[model samples]
Structure formats: structure tokens, C-alpha cells
Target: MTQLPPRFEISRQDIARVVAVFYERIRGHPGLGPVFAAHVDDWPSHEAKVTDFWANAILHERSYDGNPVEVHRRAGNVRPGMFDTWLALFDHVLAREVTPQQAQAWSALAHRIGRTVRAGVVDQAKGPGGVPILR
Candidate 1:
């Protein structure tokens, strides 16, 4: 009988690795670094949040519950084009470290998060003076 690969799993350690590499790239990204740097004071806390978020999103671990869209909106005017750049960076890191299926899942997750965040921001912006509720 032929052996097959085991079911894919998103471990906390694996998610940490991905988040680390992703942030490494994000830190160097010209478009996002300044914005991230200006706002995020605690790198470890931020990394932990991302790790939990991805683990929950991809692995159904339920390790994260905070509002992601609120987090993004707090960054202020995350121009539409930034999502593409963010996705590109995420894909690059994920591809370098994870399986194809894992990468695909992450890509889809990122798009969903981006859309959710964007929609929340846009909806909040529609209020009286075109400003988001959180920031």
C-alpha cells in the first residue's frame, strides 16, 4: 500500500514562525513599515496577537477573539492599495515557510481579513463626516 501525507495542521510554533517571517518582511516593506512602526509599540504583543489570529483562522483553534477590523482601522487610512502590498508580503513569507495548501489557506484568510477590515472602515467612515468610528 502507498503511504500518503498526513492531514495538515497549523501548530502554534508553525504559526509563530510564519508570523515572525511575515513581520520581518513587513518591517522592511516601504509602504507599510512606517505605518506599523508609528502605531505598534509592543512588537511581542503584536506578534502574539497575529500568531493567535492566524492559528485561530487557519487551524480553528479559537485562540483569538479581538476585533481584527478595529485593529486595522485604528491604524488610520490604510489606503486601499496597502492590502495588495500586505498580501504580497504575507504570501512571500508564507510560501517560504509553509505547504502549498497552507499557503493557499493563508492567502484566502488574508483576503477575508482585508475585506472585513476594509468594509468595517468604509462603513464607519460613512457616518456624518466621513470618519471611522475607532479612529
Candidate 2:
């Protein structure tokens, strides 16, 4: 049986642009910048890998090969809360880079992926349940 194609159309170039712009913003973000800086020594290589990741997720291409959850969990510095900040910035980039339909679809996929990553990272850490996230 033939597999159905992705619901929305997005190109490798589009993914590359989004990844590039998003990372540029990330490097400047106070909360996220430091976190990413601690891990990523090379921005262009990181962006290319991330572009491959999105292409695999959205375009069904076989460019990316790795587990994001495992990477985040291993990072140790990646907090569960960081996914929110990451997604927010990513969505902002999507809004400016892609068509609205593509952005919505990509954002939905991203949130789903983000939640998985968050769950994986959160499982490795513990906090007092009664304590609030923000004081």
C-alpha cells in the first residue's frame, strides 16, 4: 500500500531557514542562550543537524538521525521548563518564515515533540510537588 504524504508541504530550504533564524534568536536569548551555549560549540553544524531533524519530522526525509529526548536528558542542564521557551521562540520564527498553515502544522508537531522531550527530561529530575514553578 502507498503511504499517504504529509498533510502540509515544507521544503528542506524552509526548514533550513527556520532553523538558522531560530538559532540566531536562541543565541541571544538570556534564559536559553546560556543553556545552549554550554552545549553547542559550533552553530552552523548544530543548525544543519536541526534542519535535518525538522526535515525528517515534517517532510519524511531521511536526513536526521538521533534521539532528541536522549540528547536532552544527557545534557543534564536541560530543564523541563526550557522546552517552553524553546517552543515559544521556534513558533515566533515559524510565524515569520513559513505560511500560516505550515506554521500551524509545524507548531503542532513541535509541541508534541517538545512534550516528549520534556517528559523525558523531567523524569530524570525531581522537585517538591507543592513548590510552584514560578515564584
- For each candidate, what TM-score against the reference? 0.80, 0.90
Give one digit per residue, the lDDT tens place, for model 2 in 6-123: 6589878988999999999999999999999999999999999998898888877778999998998899788877888899999999999999999999999999999888887877
**Candidate 2: lDDT of 26?**
94
Model 1: residues >4 Å from true position, as ranges? 1-8, 124-135
lDDT of 1 at 52: 88
Candidate 1 residue lDDT tens string, 11-122: 7798899898888877887879988898879988999998888777766666798997787667675655577788888888888898998888778878887877777666
Give Cα-based local distance difference scores for all models: 0.77, 0.87
What is the Cα-based TM-score of model 1? 0.80
Against the correct fold, how does model 2 do in TM-score? 0.90
State each candidate's clash count.
0, 0
